[model samples]
Target: MQQIIKFFLRNKTFLLYVFLLFIAVVFTIQSHSYHKSKFINSANYVTGGIYNSVNNLSLYFNLESQNLLLQEENARLHSLLSTPNYSTSLSFISDSIYSGISYKFTPAQVIKNSYSVKNNILLINRGKRDSIKQDFGVITPKGLLGIVDQRSNKFATVLSILNTNIKISAQLKNTNHFGSLMWDTKSPQVVQLNEISKIAPLKKGDTIVTSGRSVIFPKGIPVGTIQDFRLDSAENFYTIDVKLFNDMTNIEYVYIIENVDKTEINSLLKPSNE
Candidate 1:
């Protein structure tokens, strides 16, 4: 306290000049309309700039939350579309037996992704607690991503479509000619569709999609467009190079699809032991 008093005594003349200058400036602005207007405009400009900067900073921090909300909304919309009676006029539908809904979508975030290796895998922020299980199909708004291969209580691993070990049922759009979607470990942006019949009207830019022959992916989920194709050794099937819709290297958000009838379908397909 004594030191503060001594310091104020030492700087009293300078402090007094500063205080008088501030008072004079305030009085001059108040007395002159032009000066007052100029001062107000300058104050507004400074405050407006500060407010805008703060607002932009807040928005930057809120981006992750906004992305999460968008993912959830997307999942809801997908779930709605999977219902048997989805209509433009309807706002909601009950998931009852009469609703005939087979698929349920759960939104998830990718924590880790790999695409350069021969057997790339992805890790998602959903697991057993979120109803994620092995063989569950994962996708984004653009296209199919992969299938869930393993899960814990809070996380799951996906066998990415870029993996050579994974095979998915894909077909040419609007045709019965289907093949196994596989990766050639060559390009991350392209996948291979094997066993497609050569006589199935081969053409460049033809879209390929899920066939719905398996319990994993629903029918008509886009895989890619036909980039190029070539006949195999025996000339019986065509090995198609499909340009993928999703960029596997940049996956962030995903939807885990649960086919509710999968267990029942698998049970029926199992061989019976008499």
Candidate 2:
């Protein structure tokens, strides 16, 4: 207590000056309209800066949640847009709500991807637990990715379009001519379209998309663009080189499509005579 008193006494003059200065500044600000307004503005600027900084810090930590929400929303929209309508029969006096949606899209993140191997495969975070199954088509927003070939309870493996054994039904955008899309194992960005007739009116920059004849992907889903084409040994079909829109080496998120009527279609197509 004695030391504190001595310390205050020694700084009495300085303390008195600080007190008077604070009072004079307060009186000046209150007496002048411009000064008072400026002081309030200055205080607001400091407080506003602090609040903004804190808000930004909170947002920075919530990016992952925001991204997941966006992915889910995209999956819902994709399902609505990509599902095919298979209603061929209509009654004159209709009282039924015809839901055109016959397909379901499940969003998934790629945990593993391979492009250099001959039989490249992709591993995704979703599996049979998420209703994913074999033969489901995998795609990104920009283009086709792969097909689901194997799955467990919590994970699934996709046969990438870069795989040589995998073949997809693809057709030229300008014509009805369709062919099998396959990888050549030579380049990651290029694939081959076989069985397209030589005289299909193909152009250098023609777009190729899914044929929709299969139960996997919907028709008109973009696959690639024609880079070069030449007649095969028999000259009946063209071996087309397609430049892919999606980079095989760099894939992240994908949507898996499930055709709800796939089993029914397969049953109808099955040949009982054989």
Candidate 3:
């Protein structure tokens, strides 16, 4: 401290000049409206540029949070818009509410996903705490993502649609024909739906979607478009290549569907087998 005092005493002349210059600028701005206006404008310009650069730097790190927020909003909208009206107990595909099935979506973030492996799986950052659980169907806004295979309090693992073990009931849109959705394990973009009846009308671009044949997923959730089709050697069913609506390799967020009456549905099936 004493050394610093000595140094300041030695350079007091320069310091005094710097102090005087600061006083002169303040006085000039105070005395003249034009000078004050110019000073304020210059300060604003410099500070504005600084703040903008800082905001951009911070935004680059906050993209994941923004993405999750968007997914949450989408899920909320789906809760309202896509929810089926359950009225009749007979048909599953009712534009009105139907008694056979009901579901709600839980938005989730994909912290890890594997598409190249033969048994593909996705680890999502939503779990029992968020009402996500095993057997829950996962989907993005574009299409079906997969099925939840396991869960903890704060995380869930999904058997991705790209997995060879992944099988879900699906059907052609605008028709009652149903098939089994399966992945070939060769490409993440394509999956096959087998057992579509030969007599059902198969168009080049017909949409495929969840069939509600089982309780895993609600009917009419988009699967993909028919890319190509041909009868197997058995000639009893159509093997169709469906171009998936969701890009599995690039998924970041998804919605977990919890069938509202899954237990009741499963119990009824159990009694039939017994």
Best candidate, lDDT-wise?
1
Q: 199 in model 2: Cα distance from truth in Å?
A: 1.7
Write out the backbone clash pairs for model 3. Answer: 85-96, 85-97, 85-98, 86-97, 86-98, 87-97, 87-98
Give the per-residue lDDT of model 2 (tens digit) for 67-175.
Answer: 6646865897678767687333443445456455668889887666679877777777676679887789999866899888766666677788987667899999988
Q: Which lDDT tens digits does candidate 1 get at residues 82-113? A: 99886754545664554567799998877666
- Whole-model Cα lDDT per candidate? 0.79, 0.78, 0.76
Residue-level lDDT of model 3, residues 91-193, one tens digit each, is: 5565656544478878776766578887776767676678776688888867888887665556666777887676899998898899899887768889999
The ten-residue window of minimal lDDT in model 3 covers: 34-43
Candidate 2 residue spans exceeding 4 A from truth? 1-98
Clash count, one per candidate? 0, 0, 7
Winning model by TM-score: 1
TM-score of each: 0.67, 0.66, 0.65
Q: On lDDT, who's better, 2 or 3?
A: 2
